[model samples]
Target: MLTILDKYILKRYLATFVTMLAMFVPIGIIVDVSEKINFMIENKVPFLKIAVYYYHFTIYFANNLFPIFLFLSIIWFTSKLANNTEIIAILSSGISFTRFLRPYIIGATLVSIFVLIMGFFVVPVSSEGFNNFRYTYLRTNGQQAMRGDNTDVYRQINDTDFLYVNSYNASSKTAFNFSLEKFDKDKMVSKITASRIQWNPADSTYTMYDYKKRTVGALGDVIVREPEKKTKFGFELEDLTPVIYIAETLTLDKLTAFIDKERARGSSNINIYMVVLYKKFSVPISAFILTIIAVSVSAMKRRGGMGMNLTIGIAIAFGFVFFDKVFGVIAEKTTFSPFIAVWFPNFIFGILAIFLLRNAKR
Candidate 1:
């Protein structure tokens, strides 16, 4: 039971969304190329690799900015409809505002599903490539970037085991000043120290250099020393080296498991990871929220017409981005809950959408 009006509005909504994405993605590419062309030329990166990198970059950019584009497009098209008296005409034809919103809701639902898929699967793969290329070619130094807060790694391997490393090189799979401590209940059982540790991929073991171990017992303590020792620990090499974008490269299920693993390890930056996890769902849900807000704000005929609606839409979109960033930083820097930080803007804007929709209906 589809009406002509429903199909018309739905088609326009989706068409405008795609058109906006098409327009903005090229601009993004041009600006990014202008900024990175020198780096590509200096690095002597092949044209094919550069093209592939930008392809990943396009997916990353579009996925990240979809909500902003969605909001703006809805405002643009709905405002035009208002200016042309189409909204009034439809209302006079006995179509209620609530009925008019059906197509928009359907469109938002479709976009939300797409966003969800992108967040859970597509974006992660693209983000991995995007970050890999940026680090490999765009960064000035050959040094691979580490997480800002993860320098000098330390973590609990399990209930009875703890680990520490003074410095680590991800590319080399090596660490310096490695220490592992084991405890039995409240008593210290043993401690191992090594001058350096390197992963032996062939054996799936770590080779510890200048290895020393001390075991404590009721009667006495025993000490052992070795020049080098190959041993398997409870943790893997990937556990020792964590990158800033590690969370961005995991799917929803993997990210959930990762957060749990990091929590068990007593990681200090768990909040940052939690933010990424929550944002995957929040960003897509924001599409529905923003669609409502956009339609509410722009579905009224006004003196300034489409220009005024677009201006308001842009301002609101920027404000949403600002709130999201500020609160996310607060969660990262302070003790604020990541769940609240990730969803606070949506909560605030959802209320705005409700208020605006009511006013528009009146």
Candidate 2:
């Protein structure tokens, strides 16, 4: 079922893509180390931890540039084939352009599958390590970075209870001006307020200062106060203070569950999380479109040769990245649809690929 030509092109396709990743990933690591070496040293980070961090960084870096590298590799090798007139000779043997594209399609399918696995499962673990290392060692406002929007925090715990905090400090595991209100139907049942609350991780309990509880009854209201009180709450610290990068650290199923939980809590960052989830699927899908465009752009022997083709290819690749980032930010910040933001780049470039394919066939 396999021909020599299919095997040859597929070999070149996969081999070149691997080589590109090998080359660029190391360079990216070096640049990152150069920038962060002083920070690592200042924090007295151990060498082994640094090594592990870069291991995770390698996956994160490669995943981010996967589509770009795949596009460039395809362009580079296919341009070489064109320059050698190998494509012309192959076409003269009566193979249709669509048929000639079969191996490339197969190669794209393979790469897309790998991308899907990496995006949905592997990259999340790497992202957690990469971001945790930065927040723990390199960032100045590490607590603020780890705990998103520590001020004016609010959460709907369940159908009957709601919570509010004026401010939280992740470093100290403390919250100020905390309140929990429980409702029975449309009426308030009881409300608890604390001037300060601190988690005692040693005993898995919370110590509150100036704590007060007010209960509403049919006859009247009853109130109890204490200067210092220790008790357990229904929620954990994470429920009160979720990290900004929590979405990036969760795998497909966990991410989906987290989104559902956040939705129930009426979180304002739903759009941002939606963008991340959509991109996990969209990034892999772009591999197919990028491969098609790369082949169409580089399959013809142009007057400007491989360099010209590469220039064009790189421009298109960056333009794709630019669109992706812009739309993603718009979705995250404004009310734009995350689905459109994630997939619009592929849709636009898909049209470009079609036009270029027609010209290449001519």
lDDT of 2 by residue, 111-216 (tens): 9899899888999999878876775566443333334444677777778888888766554778889999999889999999999899999989999999999999
Q: What is candidate 1's TM-score against the reference?
A: 0.83
Looking at model 1, residue 20 earns an lDDT score of 98
Ten-residue region with minimum lDDT total, candidate 1:
142-151
Q: Relative to the unseen true structure, what is the C-alpha lDDT of residue 112 in candidate 2, on a scale of 0 to 100? A: 88
Best by TM-score: 1
Count clashes in each candidate, considering only residues at least 3 apart in sequence or on different chains: 0, 0
Estimate every model's Cα lDDT from 0 to 1: 0.87, 0.87
